[model samples]
Target: INGARLIMVATPANAHGDIAEQLAPFLKDDQIIMLNPGRTLGTHYFYNLLEKNGLKANVIVAEADTLIYTCRLVKNGLCRVFSLKKELHVAAHNPDDTQMVCELLSEFYDVIVPAESVLETGLSNLGVIFHPVPVILNIARIEEQSTFSHYKQGISPTVATFLEKIDNERIAIANALGVKVDTAVKWLNRIYRTEGDTLYEALQNNVAYTEVLAPTTIHTRYIYEDIQTGLVPLSILSKELGIENSAMDCVIRLASMLYNYDFYLNGRNEGIIDFQKIINSRKVAISR
Candidate 1:
């Protein structure tokens, strides 16, 4: 109903802010807009849109500390939750609304923590941005194989270091943007319900992240799932936020170069015959 007090938007990371922008005009002054999984720019985008559109509605961009902790079933336009959170942490444009929003969410969720700000909840995200790079770069060898199991694969020590690097960069970026980030690594372990202090330690210590991987070397879904969708969103977010970063740019550039090689090889085998053109075009742009 247009009279709804709370509006929740769940879309891809890149699309959430825009969706909120379009919905701003329809929202009542007291209505709360929540973006599930605000990844990075979710709050900034929504705030910018409200200012740009001259909307006076109270907007809150809330992020799930863990990815929607429920087994949900959708049928006949109804969502059934087998398990739901007891509490949720919410960050809003106005810190004063935290309690009110928490009270509203308490109807569906068991608990709601009033985070000092939305940035706190946003930075505490355990999934998308932080877990992508290690899954991709570390599994490059397996991605060339015929088949592989993604979820079951174990993380190598070297790859663990990479993940830490990415996590550090993310935290630094968040701080630079005036967003106080909680311990991202520690939060990841907490969400996973593991004993390790960080994802790296969890991978090494926890029996789950170290499950027996598939024997076959075929491509795993991790690359596309985490790298393409997850990491790409983070890179884009960092750029938009004007966060100082060279490590992420390097990783992205390396991935692009590797993808170019794949494209060239596939084209050669398929008689696509335009490899030189691709190189020339990119070179011209670089020269520009």
Candidate 2:
């Protein structure tokens, strides 16, 4: 990597708010801030918070369709670039300087699709639809058994149909909320560089989903915190806009239940999930 003037972040959506808050102080007015995957309101929230806190930096937020690549640290300061994305869309909040930011980025990136606004680019988040179902549905199965791979379960015709239906509901909710979202299948292919039409079709070529599902770790990061912080608030916003579709409703309710369960567990000083504060912060969104 070159001596870049700015660095964008790509972490789980739940971490966006906290990271943005912490990073504001280190940045200067001439520097830029970018969220590689702008989980709803992430950039704007950081920008506003920085302005309110008296930080004068120029923040630039972009939303690529997918991470554009998967990265894992192999050693200290060395991350393996497991993949490379072909093209991506990006935008800046300041409409006047959007083109300038995109032009600057194009020097490092091969293809940069300049978007109308950061909001338009941010709304195209792939994680929004793909992340929730497997964890929640698997949790239901884990309640029935100690260990289970929902991926194997998802391959069944019945469960696959359920996923498809639920995905449609996610898209509907996004549309109703005026968030730009595409089919999960499309994003998967774009990110994975696959020829398949759907995620299931792509799965046929790889056994990871079937054989090696996500570990059944009892961490609060993915299941409880993610939904409470990211999905539930978005879902509530969607519902308020009259998008009370069944699947979205179910997902939201499940997150709410899990969040409450997390509180009860933490109250007893039990092994708790992290990001509990995120769940508590939902009071603000829920009350709106």
Candidate 3:
């Protein structure tokens, strides 16, 4: 890691903090640390962690809105890649470093593209709209150990409609914070090149989702990881910006009940992230 110029963190969102603490001691100045699919506000959380862990290196921390590949583990030591995204949006913690980070990353992946800022990448997290709700809706089948495609079978027309409502609330929060982010429907088309008038249609049209299977148990990352790292921060931001977030709130509350855990208390909030700093940074980036 010390010898590497570019360090990519591809772990689940929940593990980011631990990874940050472990890497802080060894991180070198001018090195780049990128979170693959930062979920939401991931780089912010990680950067803060690094600082708290006594990191003195002037490293550039960046995050991607999504992973470059739609892949899954086939078995131990084996993985299957369904497809690679034609384009991927990445942004640095400091907006000024975004282009340099993208340019450096492009040597490894030509598909990399610079995003407006970390706010855009955070708000553009599609997994916040896609992952958790379906699992909650399909709890019965999942508990019964019934096999089904996560995107295709789990997300019915009705579930998809509800998911869109969640997406609408997310976009509303982004708008209130002065960040321009793609709606889930638009993001699907851009990433997968799947055409549809609605998010449900676009998801169904995405061939990459065909082989993705739903978790058979409740203790999956769909709920724990997405709710903790993705939806929780969105809920916090919506409150800070005075945006109505009943849809997000409902999901959070339901997830709490299902898991018998208070996600809000353990997840990112005002205490973990400075909401005003995030808002101010986005405003400054917009002015530039």
Candidate 4:
């Protein structure tokens, strides 16, 4: 166990803390743990857990903007690789170590770009933009077991308009926190190698989204986890940063009604992060 140098965690956002807890006993000082596609500031959760456990592991924790490979397991132990992401974003809790981590990661991935910090990597997560809204908007089609493609046909103009608002709030939160990030449209274009004048067009024309199937029920993670992890934090950050996040709030409320669960009380934003401190510490970490 002592020989471990880096560990990449690619679990559901909700399971990250649990996994970190399990690994706390084995993790040694200076080990690297990276959260693949940290939906909403997930690195903070992992870092905080290690500290709370009193592990004294000087771990280099980091997170990615999204998973490197878009893939599915067609069968047990069988995976189908979709498109490898063209651009990958990552940052460490310590900004000075970000380049080292990215260089190490680049050995495994063709592209590993440094974000401002983990804040930028976490905020850059497109899961908040991509997963929830279209599922909610196409509930009828989903419930009816329609074969509509999740991205190509599911995201109509109406869905795109709603996504735009969510992206706006996301951008606003980043701006308020003094980080630069992308709108969903611009991000999608870059991620999918698509040329589009609009978000809907970008999605529809993107080959990566072709044949993507819609979720079949409201019980899916697209709603549950996205609301709990994605929209919840966006709404929380919007409130903190004094931005209007009506669309995000409305989505949370609607999801609560649909599933009859109190997402706010059960969401991930309960002192899960002191983002400003994380940023400020990065400055100190880099200056040393």
TM-score top scorer: 3
Error of 1 at 267 (Å): 29
- On the 0 to 100 scale, the lDDT of residue 171 in model 4 is 93
Worst 10 residues of 1 by lDDT: 263-272
Off by over 4 Å in 4: 275-288
The candidate scoring highest on lDDT is 3
Clashing pairs in 1: 86-110, 86-111, 87-111, 145-217, 145-218, 146-218, 147-218
**lDDT by residue for model 4 over 33-107, one digit each (tens)?**
988877787777777777766677678888888888888878998989977877788988777888999999988
- In candidate 3 the C-alpha lDDT for residue 269 amounts to 72
**Residue 134 alpha-carbon offset, candidate 2, angstroms:** 0.7
Per residue, candidate 2 scores C-alpha lDDT tens digits across 1-288 of 133466777775556556666776667655666666665445554565555555655555545444656666679988889656666777665667678777887888877877765545644554445455666656645454456554555345454555566667667655654446667666556555545665667545444445544435545355644454345544544544456556655766666576455322322111221123333334343467
Using TM-score as the yardstick, the better of models 1 and 3 is 3
Error of 4 at 186 (Å): 1.4
- State the lDDT of candidate 1 residue by residue for 1-288, as single tens digits: 288777776554545535755776766766677766555434655666666666766555455444355544367667666555555667664567777777787787666677766556655654544444544554555555534333334445566666676677678655654566655556546645656665566655555444434433323333333343344445544555566556655666665575552321211111312223323443464467
RMSD of each: 11.2, 7.8, 1.8, 2.8
Please report, in order, the local distance difference test score of every candidate based on alpha carbons.
0.54, 0.55, 0.88, 0.79
Cα miss at 158, model 4 (Å)? 1.2
